[model samples]
Target: MKGSSKTHLRIVFTLGIIVLSIYESSSQFLNDEFCGNKEVLTLDYRKKPWKGKNQFLLDYLKKIDYKDNIDSVRFRIPVKFWIYRNDDGSGGVTDERVKVFMDSLNHFHKLNNTGFRFYIREIESVNKTKRLNLGYFVEAPLQTIFNHTKACVNIYVCDFIKKKANGATYVVRGTYNIVTKSVMLQRNTSSTGLTHEIGHYFGLLHPHRNYKSGKNKQESVSRTRAYKGSLKKGLICERNGDGLADTPAEPRLNFLVDNNCNFSGQALTDNWGDHYQSETNNIMSYPTHYKCRNNFTLSQKSVMLYKASENKYAKYWNTKDSANKIYHFDIHEPDNTVKMASIIKSNEKQNHTFHKIFTTGKKGLATDKTDWLKFELNTENTSNILIKFTPDKIVNDEITITIYDEDNKLIKTINTSKQIASSQIQLKTLKSGWYFIEINKKQSVSKKLYNYSVELIIE
Candidate 1:
């Protein structure tokens, strides 16, 4: 009986090992022959902070005559590519494919006089089986690990992106978000896919923005600027669909578009009973084929320019003018403690103001998640100190900003609750002394990068 029991235990352990091996092998490799469409998993604009920012961006762009200085306001964007291969460094995207994709990406953006150009800054090769077949959930850490360690658009090209749903696996061609400022794509993804994802990176929403949700009002087919007597009152084309008047209101152009790059399907009507006339060639649309998706409307170009000029995206642009020099370089780490705080010297010549734009975040396995800054106030009169924190990227938790004295005693604590929003603390009649400011992340598991700007004003 003892010998029989020993044999049973051995058999069970061997089976367990085999099962574990199978699971690990299956998890690391994905089907590379599946057909998929390019989809962007972006932060929902119907939500709080994103909704507010979306409206604010549109309002700000409306006030700007960006076209007047179109010739001189050209932007140069730097791009870094990460090509992933198997564990032994075999079977990844080819250099020729990357070069062709870049050419196509540039050609599409150049066609409409978009005033934006992208150039490759670096190309890195990643050899890891897990990275070769990526998933949506694993992308954040992959971004943190392969991050350029500087400011530029990071694009990861993988072998396959496995997405499981309803006991079956599907492929997601690409994804991008404003918070990460990164794009992940399958190596076989079309050049159109790359361009479309970049459009989302630049803040261009789909033409059928609210079509999938069915919760909000869809853009009506009417392009009428005068909404006093419109079918859906105040639902002008400019106010509804994509916030751009040039692109007509239409449903998702997925199956409705034909092979010849034309929308000649069944007549779909909007809520106002008007026939749809969507632009199949719009880069932001979901056309059936890559060839059918290759254009950005004139207003769309303006939107891209305005969005790229935001503080969060400042690191991606290369320019020399001081007015456009608001964003600074990445802040070095190890300033996590009070004694190791980075110095913030006020520009006495500029009204005692210390303002800078920087990028910082918590690493995956790093213990330090706080950034420290020390500044001195030498004003004699009854002065006020204003500290403002404007974040370009999204922070999942409230970033706690604590004010401490020279003795390492806490003075005040301000927790910013909004995601991708700005917060400010005003201290009236602040004493003249050395003070320290601590920017700490409340989240414990986040490894995503955060870009923000701090402005210190004393008067």
Candidate 2:
């Protein structure tokens, strides 16, 4: 405690991020949808011309000789789940179902080693009968009601979706809506359904472009036909459906794929007369059974990464930036006792400061929702200790800070509520000794975790 205010103290701790293995799952379903379809287009994909943007991205991509180690860079995407149920709250998807779906979703993405990781920022429930069923007609009303923050990928899951589509992703043009940023799905949608929809949200086009109209133009089964650096050589597969050179061209697999997940229909050919040996397990395909729709080609992965990297999609990446800017710990941790409180000591510097990002709520099997730390005061001449907690916009959780002397005698307590960001405790004529500080949330939201940050400075 001697040189508390005069010491320079620096606390450095890096969060250990462990990537988990995604679980494998297969479920059966009949139909699916992507934003390219006019029915699900929020601002009308035709008016927005996001496809042209995709073409531009593809053209730029073709110029680069890019190769990745897969593990070198992992982009974090934040997601928010909106679960809708009947007015009685009787028919919505459960948290367990969400966990399962997320597991399989991550699994499909990891299969391609896409380096894109989706993490849940929040899960909210809506008990409105009108929103229990999803369709384009109702999309506007839903959006208005929620007034989506567009802060992250918004996924709305309802009891039922319109026919012929298990899920729909809005495709906006010119970066306005970035419509592909939002997704809507049926409550019972298969893992493949969600995966397919999310693929569209990230700018993936169905291999069988415009197939529902029965006027599908065949993509040439050649990856090198358009390497001349000319967009006018447009009929080349590189300039055709889905624009990536790696995916083999094929007709819609609705009835062409059979029970064993194999192509069972007549052999198809491209405009250039090449045979179409289409992949049955492509994640962006319209396989008869959702079970057969499984993975993305490497080229598809690249396109998604490109789309997500754009400035318009900065919100998703900003979550990762915020995490890096502050120190984060496990939601179930910081289990400190009075005897084991984190210690802070200052030597020769005028002030010592530490910043921490943490979570608080009734969760896990850990101790109550509280954070504990201790600091020593060498010579108590009016001590200034500042404790500040950045408020959670969604939760707005109240917090109480208490200080205790070495003998566990109560010294001072400050209780803050509703949008309060910081609190301070000033003691005059204090004695030199170790004091314990405990921070706790006044109320908790059931099953939902809230993020909190604290900056502690002693002078």
How much lDDT does each candidate structure score? Answer: 0.61, 0.55
lDDT of 2 by residue, 1-459 (tens): 646533422111001000000000011122433322332223323432324234554454455433444532345555667888788877788765776666677777766777665655556778888877654433422342343544466777777654323354432210111233457666676676667777777777767663222213345676555434444543355545665556777777777888999887546666656666788999887677878877787668777766676646554353356643332322212223464355644421112112122232343211135656677777774766665545434444566778898989998888876656545665555588988878776544321224555555666
* Candidate 1: clashing pairs of residues: none
Question: TM-score per candidate, in order?
Answer: 0.55, 0.55
Sequence-dependent TM-score of model 2: 0.55
Best candidate, lDDT: 1
Error of 2 at 427 (Å): 40
Backbone clashes in candidate 2 total: 10
